[model samples]
Target: MNSPYSQKIVQPDISLTICGYSKVLEIVSNKWTGLVIYAMEDGIIRYGDMRRRIEGISKKMLTQTLRQLERDGLVNRKITPAVPPIVEYSLSGLGESLLVPMKALNQWTKENYSQVELARENYDRINSGE
Candidate 1:
């Protein structure tokens, strides 16, 4: 039986000119990266504060996501010289630019989450032969 939810897959055009965008998407598409960016939207935040604010993220995952964002030039990392190293993170100009679109996306998700969850439940029930 053909499921109504099933559709033909469309392959994306991955030419050299457009492929670079994939790298940007790869950076932001992770589970924790967007949350980290949103957490920093208020202002510069220390590592501990960010970790506490973003629940369910492990120390290792947060560290890795921050490092990746820094490397991609979306985030700035500042290290203070002190007995206990004080490391802080904030969005760079490029990162700030992302906030507008990210905020729109966040708003859309908040508005549509129930619809999305219902769709998911429907899909699951249909697939499960229930």
Candidate 2:
């Protein structure tokens, strides 16, 4: 029996052949992207501050993620004219717009995570053959 969920997975129309939504997800749905966005939610943050705030992120990965976000126009990188050159990052208007939905999703996950954990526990017990 085909479920409604399965039926809903139709291909995009010709006009949407490029799958713009998918492209956006490709940019934002990575493991570190959301965390980086959340870290900048307060305001502009320096590179060192962001790296310290987001635990478990390597210097290389954070650098790569920041570059990708800047390339996608979701983040703004500013370089100060000081001797050592201070670099800071902040969300662009587009990034702020994207945050609304991402915040909603974050709230939903917090609310439902316990239920999801319980479901996983039940599934594991059922399949344990014990």
Q: Which model scores highest in TM-score?
A: 2
Q: Model 2, 1-130: lDDT tens per residue?
A: 9776666557646343487877767878799999999999988999999999999999999999999999999999999999889999999999899899899888999999999999999999999996
Question: lDDT for each of the candidates?
Answer: 0.90, 0.91
Q: Write the per-residue lDDT of candidate 1 for residues 1-130, one digit (tens) a residue.
A: 9995467658644664478767567777898989999999988999999999999999999999999889889899999999899999999999999898889889999999999999999999899975
Screening candidate 1 with a backbone cut-off below 3 angstroms (N, C-alpha, C), the clashing residue pairs are none
Listed in order, each prediction's TM-score against the native is: 0.81, 0.82
Steric clashes per prediction:
0, 0
RMSD of each candidate relative to the true structure: 5.3, 3.7
